[model samples]
Target: MSADPTLQVSVLLPVYNAGRYLPEALESILAQENICFECVAVDDGSTDDTADILNDFARRDARLRVLSRPNTGIVGALNDGLALCRAPYIARMDADDIARPARLARQAAYLDTHADCVGVGSWVDYLDPEGEHIWTWKMSANPAQIEHDLLEGGIGGLVHPAMMLRADAIRAVGGYQAECKDIEDYDLFLRLLEQGHFSVLPEPLLGYRQHPASINATSNRGARTAIANRLMAEARQQRGLPEKVLTPTPATPESSQLEWIDLALLDGNWRSARKTTCRLFRSVPLKTAPWQALGKLIQAALGKLRIRAGRIRQFVSIF
Candidate 1:
């Protein structure tokens, strides 16, 4: 398809078995304000109702386009979707997250004014599967800091689904690499940063859903880390920096326990979550993850109370 001169952005969404949250994700993109965009949703051979949901939404909205093909994993799906995007800017979105109405408009405007930045992302609110806000994940707006964090595998790196990329810059790098699989976004960001800067808007413009089935929860951490380290090493070599041994942080028993605690929270198993949180506190009082877990539990409890109270108010009003 030829590039649509009237469209300012293209939302590249790749889905596989994402039926449960597909509607909300599509709504978020379709409801975007102050931007002329098209949603190129690639359905990668989903056995579930993902294709049905995409078709239904496409029927309602002419801006939505669906592409169905046999499963070729995320890399293939992303590249195919990228090829079909007809806008100058391509906003990466997942089928399970919510984007604020101004997300695309704000990012597009930033890119329009700042010619140096090849992409821009925003901080995001971490949400549980039920869409309760857990905590706000803040990212650095400084380009240098973003680059440093990406290379060091530290915090503050751009969230893949929260990013808006210059289509040309992305295509110039040969798009997402198949070898980068789970860490394709990281690899792509590194390559793009080499060509131009990346910035993060200081606002939380996306609700990043975290669940037990999410990639971060289920992927092989060891293998993912090795790929990331190698990518960082390559980036440093390209910059002519001296090679340094990139050590992978050993996962402690407490960290593993903390993962279980987080999974329990995502599963809404409050009792198990509380039990694990207490155990972590007793076992590793000085550690930060346990304390963070405790805070999340407290927040979850408060959220539940608020929900229950609202139900009671509605019941009383019915009388």
Candidate 2:
């Protein structure tokens, strides 16, 4: 399809079973100001109300274009959406994340002035499932630093959903790679870095939601780490640099127990959380880093307190 001469940006939103957060995500895009854009929302065979929501939104707004297909994972959904994008710039978005109103405007403006930059991302306010602010995730704005980090097997300031990519530059790199899977964004950023310099806006422009149902939470961490290590090795080899010995961090039983405890707290299962915490505490003495275990336990307790306090505030506000 030919590029739309009138549109300045194309919001590429690939959605799965994200019915709970889809409306907010769509509203964020539709509500963006000072930028002419089209939202190409691809529904990857969502069994939930995702398709219905998309259809209703599309009927109300012409800019939101809905495309439905079989469940083909994120990489396939992204590439397919990439093909349908009608603007020179493609802004990536997730169905569960909320973009700030000025996100598209500022990003589009930055790209307009920085001709050397092939892609740009911004810092994001990390949000919990209930839309509560967790913390601001800051990314380095320096291209040199970003490249260095990528070479060292880090993400290099390119937060996937918070990025605005040059359509041509992304296409040149062949979009998202299927082999990369869970680490697809990291791989794409590495390849995109070769085409032109990447930049990051220092300010937070998106609300990045982290929940149990998120891909990162559900994916195999070991496999992702292995893929990332391999990509870094390949990148170093291409640059004629010495290969760094990278090892995937092994998941300890204590860490798994802590995660369960955290989830239990989130779900208001105090009894289960107490039981798991006790088990974890017992196992900690056998481990090498006793202090680290204690620190983690304290952190988990603090998180639980925060969640409870937030719920209390919400309940109070209701009256």
* Winner by lDDT: 1
Go through the candidates in order and give each one's C-alpha lDDT.
Answer: 0.87, 0.86
Q: Candidate 2 has which clashing residue pairs, if any?
A: none
Tens digit per residue, CA lDDT, model 2, 158-209: 8999999999999998989999988999999889878998999999999988
Clashing pairs in 1: none
Q: Candidate 1, which ten residues in sequence have the lowest lDDT sum?
A: 244-253
The window of 10 residues in a row where model 2 has the poorest summed lDDT is 288-297
Measured against the true structure, the TM-scores of the candidates, in listed sequence, are 0.81, 0.81
Off by over 4 Å in 2: 250-319
